[model samples]
Target: MDELKGEWFETWFDTSYYHILYQNRDFTEAERFINNLLGYLDLPKNVNCLDLACGKGRHSVFINKKGFQVTGVDLSSNSIKEAKPFENETLSFDTHDMREVYKENTFDVVFNLFTSFGYFDDYDDNLKVLNSVNKMLVSEGLVVIDFMNADYTLDHLVEKEVKTLDGIDFNITKSYDGKHIFKNIDFTDQGKEFHFQEKVQAIKKEEFETLLEKTGFEIQNIYGDFSLAPFNKKESDRLIIIAKKK
Candidate 1:
């Protein structure tokens, strides 16, 4: 279980490096994409929404502002701590492992966004997160999974790149496993070096569909991009799946 062989969660924090990435970000694209998704999903207001692995509460805040009651959970304390002050009556964030089963059938929607799946060393452990997602959804409840278009990503792979942000230099490399992509980033700053790694499940369209079916979810829709367009292999930047509890 090479995937389970690493401290992925801790390294995930280092890769995103909350304070830095957020500060350097351009939210315009994210704002547009999310707004489009909200329209496509057409979820009703006043519903309970759970954002699993909701890092830094960016999506949670956006959704809450759109009138949904949102609860966000992640495995990183640093993210939870960073997200806390942004919390309000309609939104909350906490630290929780996605692999654990939560209170069953309590949410109207459970969303795992931004390629957040496929990291555990054990394949079954990774699958368990889907079970947990299903358990959190009410009858006929919806779950939306938004991940990178693995095929597209693989084809467009950039083997190595150097990026300097906030005076830190990141030497990054990316490669693909059979079902996921592995990224290693070596960070250098002020004569010191730190390595960060992340593994994202590189599921084919059929693979994700099969996983959803096996998890007792009824496939409702699949989109290739955030604009809710039909899925086309050579044309989309994202793989967005919408499913409902059976």
Candidate 2:
């Protein structure tokens, strides 16, 4: 699809251009973040992990390498296809929606990393995701949510930018309209123009605290960045939350 036709997330994320635009990803940072999280959790050997919205199984592969049985699930079938070759006896990939329980009370941990939350238009759908995670996790199992700090992101928002990757130039614009952050991407590839819009709810820390507590999860820690640093509203880059099912 050269133009935005279906849902923003599904259509855009499944496109080849999306992968090409983000090919030179910061893999080092992602690895470091996963390393810090796994070390801090200090989970038991061979514990089960469900990597929700695990695009291309990056985190799932890393976790499986750490001796855990990891199952990665994403909404994009293309991403799952890309990740299937990495699977082994203890690692697998599938296409799944985060708003539904993939398996009830089966995983010792659930990971919703890389700002995967807050895409739906309905606020209650976010609650549905949390609820689904609650059902998917066993009692006392942990859930890690790595989301962007909405306030900090809005404060330092880039209105416009052009990123050239793999000989393709992507023109992007971002803005926050009171309740949601909107990102409009425009680019031309192979002489055809494409446009995609990404919208995510600008839910804040207080909001997540309420949602998690309401969904039977007790917040154990709130870090502002992947370094496990204390949260600072004005300066931190990410809002990483670790919670346990009550």
Model 1 TM-score on a 0 to 1 scale: 0.92
| Candidate 1 lDDT tens digits, 52-165 | 988888989998999999999888888889899999998999889898866688899998988888777777875688888888889999988888888888999898998777
Per-residue lDDT tens digits for candidate 2, residues 1-246, read: 367687788988998888988888898899899999999999999689999999999889998998999999999999999999999999999999899989999999999998999999999999899999999999899999999999899999999999998888999999888988999889888888888889999889999999999899999999999888999988988999999999
Q: After superposition, how far is residue 197 of candidate 1 from its true place, in Å?
A: 1.5
List clashing residue pairs in candidate 2: none
The TM-scores, one per candidate, come to 0.92, 0.98
Worst 10 residues of 1 by lDDT: 1-10
- Pairing residues by index, what is the TM-score of model 2? 0.98
